[model samples]
Target: MLTNTVTMTTVEIAELTGKAHKNVLADARKVIEMIGGLKSQPSSLGYSEATYTNKQNKEHPMLVLDKHLTFTLITGYDTGLRHNVVGRWIELEQVANPAFAAQAITETLNELQARVNAMAPAYDEHVRKGRTVGYSWREACRLADIDHPDKLLAVLVSLGRARKTTQGHTQLHPDYERDGFIKTLKPSNLVVSKNGGHLFKITSKGLTEWLKAKAEEMNTAVAFAGVDRWGRPIK
Candidate 1:
């Protein structure tokens, strides 16, 4: 297949820069408004409508940006993020010119894939040896910044967001379940050891979900302060 230039949406920008999607959208709107005022209208240097399928498997409208607009939006970010965005743009540019960059791109991708494939057998061996490899419960809690693992585990179990082994050990629910919050751990990647019991492996996806959930919880607490669930004032 012939390679083409890759465009990014505001959602992707937010994820890359660790900004809220809404905030990125707001910034993009401001840019659009500013460009609208210019006499020499750079019609091609603005966002376009796009759709992104979120973790919920629901598609939503979003704004996509070409290289020009992506750089424009990145300018409003902090120095550190600005540098990272520039680096990412460089990567995009290289891939966008595959005719000139084919050899370098192919070698880089092959090396990365080879490394990943090389680890597969070790992961399989760990499973066969009955060793549960991956992030442990404590590691997950640390990643999520949750101080109370027991409480969180109970909540996850109650909500069917977690699984219990035959030995009554809690594991991150598999991703096969559409409604599951975390999809990082797979059955092949998990093992039940006689000594360690059942181990739940945490994944980057699970960590991201955990952080998002925590953020939502904090937002809810702030929004619902001094108000009852029925929206009545707590007087």
Candidate 2:
């Protein structure tokens, strides 16, 4: 359900958020690698131990602030975590009288939408008989309680979501990436693509088969991805 929609360029976030470029860069370092639109911190956390390196990178020095911000973003998306205390800090950030800081939580929710858009699901085999592809990996992992790399594949394979891991090939059985969907290239799998990007969808056969498999294991719940027989989630 979380998605990242309103993406700002790093420069744009710095200007709109009323933060120094260096400060923004420091705050958004880890996330920059993950998504396209980036936001900068509105202001400094003013920690005494925070140091600014004059090096070309010019990283943020305040570990406390850095930790706080990173955790804020992570916990926001992490559904498994029990605590929702990030709500309190985000509330506090709203009152700090900065440009984008006031909209921190809302902006994050928008980012979640954008991220979900980026995820753009495709059908894969659900290991069930008579089914093609149906469920997205995000829903599967959560339902199966198999977030670990080995276990994820195990469930996927058991549900016919994937084939046997090829020890010889790397991309076919890659390490777990905590970003979006698990990609597939089996001819029978779903096929997805954007207006002007590489191919990124699976086959209808893959979707049906996979959904049948998934239903056998997890019959009652609905996938938030909400993909239907036509292989599209309800927008």
Top candidate on lDDT is: 1
Report the Cα lDDT for candidate 1.
0.57
- Candidate 2 lDDT by residue in tens digits, 197-224: 2122222232333322344344333342
Tens digits of per-residue lDDT for model 1, 165-204: 7756656556522433333333344344531333555444
> Runs in model 1 with CA error above 4 Å?
1-6, 37-43, 99-235
Where does candidate 2 stray beyond 4 Å?
1-30, 34-72, 75-84, 87-184, 188-235
Q: What is the Å distance of residue 5 in model 1 from its true position? A: 4.0
Error of 1 at 201 (Å): 57
Model 1 lowest lDDT segment of ten: 176-185
State the lDDT at 175 in candidate 2.
22
Top-TM-score candidate index: 1
Per-prediction RMSD in angstroms? Answer: 15.1, 18.0
